[model samples]
Structures are given as structure tokens and as C-alpha cells.
Target chain A: MNISEIRVLIGDDSILARKQMKDILEEVGVKNIEEAANGQEVVEKFRSFKPDIVFLDIVMPVKDGTVAISDICAEFPDAEIIVISSVGTQSYLKQAILNGAKDFVQKPISSSKIEEILLSRFERS
Target chain B: MYTQLFGNYLLSKNIITPDQLVDAIRKRNDVFVQPNTIAMHFKLISATDAEYVTKIATDKDSDFISTAINLGYFTREAYDEVKDNTLPEYLFLGQSLINDGILSSSKLEEYIVEYQSNNEMIDLELYSDQKDNLDQLLLNLFIIANEELPLYIGKYINLLFTNLIQFIGEDFTPLNFLPCEEYPVSLCSYQRINGVHPLTMYLDLDEKVALEFASRYVGESFTEIDEYVKASLEDFLNLHNGIYNVNLSNESSIEMKLDPPVFIEDTSITPGEKEQLYMLPIVYPFGTINFLFEIEKQETTSLF
Candidate 1:
């Protein structure tokens, strides 16, 4: 996928995590990027950024990714969202997929994970 | 009740050697002597940055942001800024290597799609895998060692291999310690270094279990480390080792060794520095646990 052509939204609660994700996204040639701190923020950013892919955190302060995904999916069923989280439980993974999240990424986000998410969601689709 | 019952159970089972039991305690007192701590001592991060994440923040149940933001180091906005970018802590790079780039690009994309499209909520219940089991055992070892030798250094380590073995019922090989500047040691990616000091321990269990165990130990009952707690911890390791031994008794008669428990005071011991005191780590069911001891004399009740 061309980095400059992809539009992405990043969400999470750890400052260190956000930086790493941003760096990794840029590394994969992603240029149009938006960011959010929680589920609610993701919603706001999702509307504003209208990204091709949204990376949402599972756990957050104002709103969690799960609820946000539900709300966004209800409104924009085509919304492309991924649950970003530190805890990797099977149940959560299943639920995120059910709720409209396109994928999930564990904490200490890796560059490869972001690249994979973008390529599959935007480039392939 | 938890400590004595668990300790005696392991001792009677003969899972861990007397020497290993003692070493566990020593390792605990010297807990602060890890390579990361040593890095702090060497001024890698500011004194504030070097401050170990408190017991609460380190726990599995604790909220990550609450732990960091409560520190008063960063404002909500600043914290949010970093959090949104998904910037990883420097410590996590090592664990990411397993599947980060190893999978084929298409396979990786498939997993990501599965991840993003999924909407399942994670259950907060505690579960055990071989990794969790190993973590539980290592945690017990740490608890037991800390109980016996509150002032001595305790250490744990994990052996790294391309392929991880997770047999249903078998004892695995223990970790092999490399020589350290401090004698005791410890990985995650984006970070690597060596050190010395006798008061550090390391483990390479699954990060999930490590986070869970840390939460359990730090949250319940352990307010400030003291003698009473240390004794109980020693017993915990003893029992845990016994459980571990039973899991592998069919394959080998390998016995873990321990040193006589002792105390430490005043004299400084730095980990990842001073190369003379290194401990070798062996692989267990899930991972490795290793430690080094720094002794001090003190009067205490006999270990009858």
C-alpha cells in the first residue's frame, strides 16, 4: 500500500504506545493519519478524519473501544475499526469482531502490526 | 496462613533445594538491582523516570493510565497525546519479536483484519496456560525468597529460543545464566545491555501472566516489605517449586538448589553492574526464573 494514499485513525491510552504507533504507521508510508485517546474520541475523530482505517484501543478513559465500535457501526456500518489493547483475551477478540472492529492489536504496538492492519483493511480491500 | 501452608507443602515435596530457597529470599531484597534499575542508577532516565513503577501501577488489575497519570508527571492532555500515537514503552520491544515480523505478510494481514473487524469484549477473569503456570511458580519462588531473606537479592530468568516448548506434563530445562557485571541478571525488544550486582532476578514468562502475577502480589496484603512477609514468601516458593517438580518428575530428577537465607543492610549492591555475581537461568514449564544473593547477618527465629 502506498503510504501517502492511506488515511488512518489511531486510538489508545498510553503516550508511549501512541508514539510507537505513529512512528510505525509513518514507516509503512501512511501519511493521512488521525488520533484519539478513548472510544468517544475515536468517534469524534472518525467523523472528522473519515479515515480509511481506524485503530481503536480496547480500554480507555472517557469511552472504551468496544462501545465506540458499537456506536460507530450502528451509525456507519461500513466503519473500518480495529481494537487496540494490551490485554489479549480470546473473548475480547471475538467480541471486537462482532461489534464492527476490523481487527485487534496488543499493547506495546509493533510496527508490523500496524502495517498488517493497514494493508489488509485498505490495500487489499 | 497462605505463606506457611504453601511453604511447608513445597519443602516436604522436595521440589526446590534448600539452597535455591535461600537464594530466592536473597534475590528479593536485591530486587531493585535489576538491569533496568542499574540503567536508572547509571542515569538512563531522570531520577523521576528511574522511579520504579509502584506496586499498584505494576498490578494487572490497575488501570494503566491511572497509574501513569496519578504520578503527576504528565497532564491528561500530554498523556493523551502519547497514548493516541500508540507509542510503546521501551521495555516491550523484546516480546513483540515473536510474531511481529515472523509471519508472512498475507498471514499478518489476515490476523490484523480479524483483530480490527472483531468486536468481542475481554473477560477480566484470571486464566492459566503453561506460561501462567510457570509465572505462578516463579511468583511463588519470589514470594518465598523475599520472605526468608528480606535484605538479600533474589533473581529469576527466562531462556530464549526460536521455538517454545509447551508440553502438557513435563519438567523443562532451567535457564543458563551468563556472566554479569553484577553477578545476577535479566528482555523485551528495542533494549539490550549487560550488568552486575548480586541482588537482581529475571523471568521470561508470558507477559500476560507476568502482568497478572504482579497485580496479585502487589495488590493484596503487601503494603511495605517486612520480615513477616519475607518468611511467608520463602514458603510460597517452596510449595510452588514442589508443584512444578511434580509436573516434571516423570522425565528427570533435576533438583533446584537454594542458599541459606540472609539479610542485607546499608551496603550498596547494584545489578547489571559489577560482573562477578552472575546467576544462570534455566527454562521451566513456561519460562525461566533466576536470582543472586547478597548476605547480611541478623538475629531471627530458627527455621525449624
Candidate 2:
């Protein structure tokens, strides 16, 4: 799939975090993007929106990103959910990967990392 | 970091008025380093000698390094090193005050001496990313609060300063501790740092300071304090704690986690059950904000 045609979902509790990721995704020419303020919302959006790429934060209100990742990946099986969170501790990273997250990037997120992920995802290998 | 600290010191010492300090802070960003200022920091030239060199260099329209070297105020070897050296931002505060005629170079020299002697932080310029210097700085802050500095807490405070400079602007200083009980909530956000180092941190400041802080953190200006502005404060605290958690885990295998920030509208706040509240006030170019760290007290196991 082309980079611009890829769908993106951002799940973070902070409005700042969502806006920041949205700005970076737009900068990278990703046109279809969806946002969820909490883990529950993100999981629901994932089921309905079926975004190709998901950015999840660990700490959220009702449900957490780890749980959301597990939920989405369990049903979809091929879900591409990346853990974008501040608390990227050893256990957190292990759990995120084991539970179904594709990659983990610690916050505050940088454009270079986003670009690298996108390039790696869309490039013909 | 020491730049804002020195500015705070001048205000505390009554050497410069609050208005003068704020004015200097607003203009301190305009200050670029000069060789004379670097020489003064190196102690190769006294502040008065620096002043004289500056005057002569100005009148003759000559370069300061060559003028000072010719005047025997600085040796050739000193000139070679000092020419390449840059002044610490700490001196920018004093330089700004001097330019505004609010202070004299000689008086600034005296305060620098007294402040260094008191805090044992001797020279701000040499505070070069050294762990020892950071520990000393944290110890001095604890000394100001009339308490002992624990090593564990020191690590967190050190990371706090590091993250503040990394995420926020460099124009800020951490003042002495503010008694938490005396605080009346204007705008406050709290987040729990859960795990081995159990603590809940709070960021409290007025709405105006919050707006400016949010602007700096997000790199965008907002005309008012709204949800995004509040989220900026929460995100900042969360971000700092998050990085600290990563450091702890990577260094010692002691993993920690952060809770989402809570914005409080209460008139006042107290520590959570079994937690003791400690507050530190940090001054930005915009205004003063407070950090309240509510540490969980250790429980003693009684053998009866």
C-alpha cells in the first residue's frame, strides 16, 4: 500500500500527544487518521475504524494501551499496533511485545522515528 | 540552569529588585557571550578589569581579547583559552542587569563570590554535565529547605531538572522548597509515579504561568488557559516522570510506572494517606510554578 493511503489511529489520553502525533503523521503524508482519548475508545475505534497503523499509550483512563493492543490484535490477528508511550520500562516493553505490539517508541515522540517506522512499513523488501 | 539560579540568588540577596530580575530575564535571551565575560568566569580577569577592558575595547573599536591581552589584564596563554571559551548563561543575568544600570560589575562580582561560597557550587561555568555537580546542586537545595538529601530522591530531582531543561525553555530556576500546606490551589495537576520509588507529583501554578508553560512545552502559543493548556502541564509532568522511570529501570532494573495526570479544582490539597508532601518552587521567565512531590512514608514492621 502507498504511504499516503495508509490509515492511522492515535490512542493517547493527552490532547497534546494526539495533536503532536497527528501533526507528524500529516507531515509524512498520511491522510486518513483517527484518534481516541482513552483505551476503551481506541479499542472500539480499532474494531470499527480498522486503521492499518495504531499508536498506543500505556497509561489511560478506563482501559490501557497494553490491554487495548491485546484486544485488537486478538480479533484482527494482523493488527499493526505500535506502543507509543512514556513508560517504556523493561517489563512494559516485554509485555507490549508479548501481548501484540509491533514496536515501542518512548515519548516525547520525534519525527525521525515516525518517518523511519513509516519508511520501513511501506518500503518494498 | 545556573543562569536562572543566579538570577534568583540576586533577588533573594536584595542586590537586585524583583522587577529588575524579571526585566533581566526577559532580555537575557538577547545576550550572546563575549570574551571578557568568559575571562571573568575563568577568574583570569576581575570584573572591574573586565569593565575597563570592555570600555577600552568599545572606545577603540578593537576586539576585547587582543585589547585585554595588550593591557596585561590577561596573559597570552589565558587569551588563547578564554578566546575559545563561552560564558555560562548564569552570567547573562548579571550582564543584563549591568547593561540596564540596575547593578555594577563590581557588585555582581561580590555577589558571585558570596553566592558561590555559601552554596559551594563555586563556578557555574564548570557545572558541565557532571554527576558530582548535580548532586552538589541538589544538596544545596535541600540545605536551603533545612533537610537532609536522600540519594534516591536526589536522582529523581536531578532527572527533574534535566527534563525541565530538555522539554521546557532553558530560562528557569528551581527556588527553595515551598511548604505544601501553605499552598492554595490556583491551577494544579497531579500524577502518580508508582512502583519502588512510590511518589505522587503535583504541578501547581496560576493560570497565567500555566499558559506560558503550555506554550513553551508544545512550541505553540495559546491566548487562554484551556484543555490543551492544562494537558501541556499534565503531559510535562507525565513526560518527566516517564523518562525518570526509564532511567531507573535501565540503570538498576527497578521499573516504575506513571498514572495519567489529574487536574484538580479544589481550593486546597493535602497529601494522600501515608504520604508526606514536599514542594519546590521553580521560576520561569513567565512566572513561578510549584512541584509537590508526595512521597509514601516507609512503614515500620513492629515485632511485639
**TM-scores for all candidates?**
0.35, 0.82
Predicted structure 1, TM vs. truth: 0.35
DockQ of each: 0.01, 0.77
Alpha-carbon shift of residue B229 in model 2 (angstroms): 1.3
lDDT of 2 by residue, A33-111 (tens): 9999999999999888989889899989898888888888889889998999888899889988999999999998999
Checking candidate 2 for backbone clashes, the offending pairs are B3-B90
- Compose the digit string of candidate 2's lDDT tens values, residues B147-226: 53234776777778778887777767666654454456788889987776677888988988888888888999988989
- Regions of model 2 farther than 4 Å from truth: A123-125, B1-44, B48-86, B96-104, B110-123, B126-129, B143-145, B148-150, B297-304
Q: Which run of 10 residues does model 1 chain A get worst, by summed lDDT?
A: A84-93
lDDT of 2: 0.79
- Give me the runs in candidate 1 sitting further than 4 Å from their true place: A123-125, B1-304
